[model samples]
Target: MSFAEEAWVPTTETECRIEGWSKETHQHGLQVRSSAEMNAQVVGILPAYVINFDSHNFGIEFQIIGSDRGWLKIRGAKDDPNRSKLPIRATYPGIGWIPGEQVAFMVQSGSGHQRPDAESAKLLDLKGDWLTSMGKIVRVVACSGEWVLLDYSLGRSRNPQTLALKRLTEAERRASQGRAWFRGVCAIQETSCETSWP
Candidate 1:
């Protein structure tokens, strides 16, 4: 079945209310009024993948089951054996709700196109400092707004860096057009890298 036809399953653990508190009051040694109040309770913390974006710890990864406005309902992965085995449609335990800005999609392998003619792409900071003179081809791992998370080797080790979408030159932009990952991300936000600033 196609992805659109598949049913969404909730796999994450979330905070839920199981029971409420009750209070009773007595006047003149007789029960005058008994009141029951609801209390908010928290479930155990769910396991989540860490998103390394500018060393920020606010980012997390979860299975997106639903979305409303700018919030997303995310649950843990179904394949995780450590997670609780629950029914997919059960809503007794809710999932997490985070802002849309904290979530990014992963670029699967073989989904990216190649530009053999493009030898290397330049890396520049927001202030225009050339981070790499001869940067290797990197894959787009995740994207948020106008920034894309790239995995590239600086010297001997590989590292991830967040780059502005407009940093690429005209030629570089043309070269990256063949990449499926870039195209998918560009469809979300309109950004051009053809500027001649640096």
Candidate 2:
């Protein structure tokens, strides 16, 4: 079920710094499954070689691509069941998060408005090098049993909604200190994917 995969790594200096992912890190031979479909089987499991912990939110920025449904659920913790899960629909490319609240993104819903578990939402107090680290993640749940974790990092130009908003240009924005939001998981390859906000 697993589909194509990618990764974000150091690149030559350029006007715009971008990242690319490839299967060189891990083999997508395994079927990609959604959090709902895989049940207990997919306990936030990740492959090796994806290192360079960010110490921020604790986990690597794992981007899952192919999926049958348009929606995906981001849980607070990998193993925690039925916790706070965010919805990432096509309308919102990158979903923002409040430091403490675990903003999990999803594409669709079954019944009433889907709400993440209250306990799962909380600010991540990551003591790291990058002071300005924000993100909006887009992911997909595929029928192949493999999922897509797209980590779209945001500029560290202050909280757009707050006075911290620095109003820096794309260049200045990229210059500001930034860090990935992931710490690494032991039992499985814990990943912290992201997307950008409007």
Candidate 3:
């Protein structure tokens, strides 16, 4: 299936940050739109929302709440819990649009959530504007509060280089039933993330 199709896989993450790798190379911000279309409508802008020239990558770690014509529909922080705010009023204020350019893709916290975040999912992996921690890659089986469940079949044969997969004893294996919870992220990373599991 296409990215847009798999992006909203129920368990898929739905959050992302628009920024460049570094400020020295990138010195621009993202233009929030009313829709995904280029000519849709200029609602607001995310200051410093960047684009790295050295590394042509955009979409990184985030919970993708939306996917349409390459646009990711994410949640916007409202001024108050009352929810009376919109773009132009704030940076990416309310569920606005951020063009999915270059390498527009979303991922979880490496082993953050092996699966996708539900409607209440916010996997941007953004800690107040700083990109950090690239965890391992694992297929998500389940997710709890602040924890993600991973799936790795240690059956007759298993791949040693399966990213963040870990070896478990017969008891542990049976307990996990070929599934285990490891620390990782699903958000796509330009480099890689570490998965602490076994």
Worst 10 residues of 2 by lDDT: 107-116
lDDT of 3 by residue, 1-198 (tens): 233322223244333323211111133455656776788787765544234456543332234345454455544422221221223323455566554342222232322222344333233322321112322222333333333333332322234455343445676545433232333333433554343221
Off by over 4 Å in 2: 1-5, 8-133, 138-148, 157-168, 172-198
The top-ranked prediction according to lDDT is 3
Give the alpha-carbon lDDT of every model. 0.28, 0.25, 0.36
Better of 1 and 2 by TM-score: 1
Let me know the TM-score candidate 3 reaches against the reference structure. 0.33
Question: Largest TM-score belongs to which candidate?
Answer: 3
- When 2 and 3 are scored with lDDT, the better candidate is 3
What are the models' TM-scores?
0.23, 0.20, 0.33
Which scores higher on TM-score, 1 or 3? 3
Better by lDDT, candidate 2 or 1: 1
Root-mean-square deviation (CA) per prediction: 19.5, 19.0, 13.4
* Candidate 3 off by > 4 Å: 1-28, 49-63, 77-90, 102-198
